[model samples]
Target: MRVLITGATGYVGQAVAVALAGAGHEVHALTRDPGSDRARALEDFGVRPLRGRLADRAELSGMLAGADAVVHTAFDPHDPVGADRALFGALADVGGRRHLVYTTGCSVYGEHAHAVLTPRTPVDGGNLRARLEAELRSAGLPHTVLRPGMVHGGDARSSIVGDWFREARSSGPVHRGRRDKVWSWIHVEDLARAYTAVLRAPEEHDGRAYLLADARPVAPLAVVEAAARAAGRTDALAFAPVEDEKPVYRVFDRDEVIDSSAARDALGWTPQESDVLAALPASFRQWSAART
Candidate 1:
């Protein structure tokens, strides 16, 4: 299969691109600058970088023309919803039978509290992520949605877990809310494998959504303490929660325990690194090495 991945240089997309290429698919990475160092790095792994941006309909359509499937992982933090709306429109304009593997987050379920989230869990339709999800479902395309939990691992500098390490080295690791609030976490490599599994058998995954996460849910403080231990700064642990007024920050205050049984049972996907606490020490080392 020929696959084109948007945001191929991003944290998740890069992993998915390499995984797809290793899985024996011809993978093309969409980028605004095909000659970038990140794009060149992908070449070392057999991925071809193609010049394109989400805002350019002609470029996106042209790229889609050659791909047997597309994994949409590109996101603009400044205007995520707007950028995706444009990308989805381009996909619709291309009008092919090609399969789409769309990336979304568990934030769509928005403050599920103590409830275990599944693919069938009711989404907070008013949330921006949920609205974008609904738009994709109604787009009349053969697509699969992947709602991954808080992703950790790989290029730790760009991961939220890495942020904890950075913070730990400075003032301290900061928790946004109660220290006991739980979060579902997944290793980046495991998340990439899920994308590979879905693409390998698109028929089985079409029109379905899967929540991807590890088997366990962990608290923020546990992850912070692990980072401190990894940094050999356990004696300097000074983590504390600070109140934030933003509605988006509320996600940190709530429990986001996700059930990924549907993905595991259907796609034969199993997380290789299920424990974030166990992985943080090595992850911190990698993050520290990257800085030096």
Candidate 2:
């Protein structure tokens, strides 16, 4: 299949491109800088980068032409009104030419995450990304929405995890919010695989939205301490108040450990996130090497 990916230069996008290439698919990635190392790497993986912004409708239409499918992995969570409708509408014009996979996060499930969210969870999201996801669903195009959990992977600096790790270790004590709560995490590579799996599943998977996550619920402090262990550091670990005005950390205050049974049974998606801490040695090494 010829797959075009938006945000192909991003963390998940790069991983997804690699996964797709490994599966014997021709990949096209969208990027602004056609000369960056990331773009070069995507090309090395045999991914052709479509140079443009998602906000440009003409570029989008041109990119979508002759494409077998598209994974809309691009979006500005902070500025949804500026770009979403343009990208989604342009693809909707494809008249169902191929699969359209839009990547959205699991925060749409809100803080009431203790309940299992199959393709059937009620829609409620606090952020722009999740709001746009719900709006995109209303377009009635051939789409599959992937709402992933708190993302954890080998790339140490790719996400908010870095701040958590640094703060917990630097603060010398880890304080978790909602103390006895649960949160689902998915390895990046694993989530990328899920993207491809959903794209190839039976048509039954269409118009269906699914959450992508592993089966474990590790608290923030536990994750931090795990990173500490992987880094050979021991600091006090405690649970902090949710009201700490550690406001930036508020983006991850919910306790959601989900069930991906729908994705597992439907697409044979079984995530290998059992020993997340084990990813630390490699993650730490990568960050260290990059710093030096």
Best prediction by TM-score: 1
Write down the lDDT of every candidate, Cα atoms only. Answer: 0.86, 0.73
Reference-based TM-score of each model: 0.95, 0.88
Model 2: weakest 10-residue lDDT segment is 246-255
**Candidate 2 similarity to native, TM-score:** 0.88
lDDT of 1 by residue, 207-248 (tens): 999999999999877887787778777574564554677776
Cα lDDT tens digits for candidate 2, 1-292: 8888888788788888889888888898888887887788788888887788878777887888878888877766566566778877778776665778888776565545445566676766665566777677687667788888777675655665655556644655455565555567888889999988976752667788888888776776567777666655665566566665643355456666667888888878888765566666676665556456
- The CA lDDT at 66 in model 1 is 82
Of candidate 1, the 10-residue stretch with the lowest lDDT total is 234-243
